[model samples]
Target: MRPKLVLFGDSITEASFSDGGWGASLAHLFARKADVILRGYSGYNTRWAVKILDKAMAGIGGDAESPAAVTVFFGANDASLPDQRCGFQHVPLEEYRENLRSIHAYFKKKWPSAAVIFIAPPPIDEEARIKYPSGQAERTNEAAGKFAKACIAVAKELSTPVIDTWSKMQEIPNWRKSTLSDGLHFTTLGNKVLFYQVVNILIDLGLSEEKLPADLPYFYEVDPNDPSKTFG
Candidate 1:
């Protein structure tokens, strides 16, 4: 069986299979080489993720090799303003950090051989968020940055790789407009950026298509005149 690659996170991750989404891009890039599994929950925070981690991971890696890789992307909702409409999703900064640590620890305990990667929350655009239908002004770029830092710090302590989406996106010119669709969610361009970053890291971790063996015989090797030669 092909190895698995898991994506675990909140809303952004939930929508990652949409057309032109980063998760979909990863799935396509790893086709025939690995299985990309998504376990995203919309409007969830670290607090909630911790509650369901075991169940979410249940049945995975059973009687087979553990996932080759797993990406944990959360924090956007956790950074929500505690007094705002989305306050229910807010998690204290310190607790947020601890939650990340707990998550990494859990994964390592369950799948010590799996390569775990954390994805820091992307920068938020307050204006765009205000313009969004919810218009609750629930999050701010500054808060997101703080959460991102906490995420990176956790990754450092755990000695795991991380994709600093917050800083990376901001480095791009006009990222607010070009990368985000409603300040928080990614636009197609944003997806493209994340896709490349993810692919690059996976390559570095030796999970690239070139490095992984395809699951079945290559099409070219199949003899049309005598199918059993390759099959049998």
Candidate 2:
């Protein structure tokens, strides 16, 4: 069976299977080499995610091969202001850090061989958030940056790879429109940037499309004189 790459995160991850999304990009690139599994939960914070992790992991099959890599992408919601409308989703910065550590520990215990990657949340566009009020707590780039830093800190402590989308996106000019869609989510270009970031690290972890072997032989490998030679 092909090895798997699982995406574990929140709304950003949940929508990653949509057209021009990062998840879709990975799935397309790894077509026959590996299975890219999506386990995204919209409007979820680390607290809620930690609670459901075991149940989510159960679907991978206890006896089956462990995933080659897993990405923990959250923090966007956790960065919500405690006093804002979306305050209910807010998880304290310290708790967020601890939760990330716990998540990394759980994965390592279950599959030591798997590469665990953490993705810091992207920067928020305050003006956009105001224009398109989605009932989510009013978030600011500064607040999100804090959570992103905490995420990086946890990844460093755990000695794992991390993608700091929050910082990277801002490097681009006019990032508010170039990268973010609703001030919180990703635009197509944003997805491309994220996809490239993920693919680069995955390549480093030996999980790239070029590194993994395809499951079956090519059509050219089959011989007309003996079809069984290829089938068998």
- lDDT (Cα) of model 1: 0.91
lDDT of 1 by residue, 1-232 (tens): 8989999999999999999999999899888788999999999999999999989988877535789888999999999999888889999999999999988888888888888999999999998777455666789999999999999999988889999999999988899999999999999989988888888889999988898999898889899999999988
Cα RMSD for candidates in order: 2.0, 2.3
For each of the candidates, give the backbone clash count: 0, 1
Candidates in order have lDDT scores of 0.91, 0.92
Candidate 2 segments exceeding 4 Å error: 131-137, 220-229
The local distance difference test score of model 2 is 0.92
Pairing residues by index, what is the TM-score of model 2? 0.93
Enumerate residue pairs that collide in model 1. none
Across residues 1-232, which tens digit of lDDT does each residue of candidate 2 receive?
8988999999999999998999999999998898999999999999999999999888784534888999999999999888887889999999999999989988888888889999999999987776334544389899999999999988988899999999999987899999999899999999999999999999898787887899998778889899898897
> Among these predicted structures, which one has the highest lDDT?
2
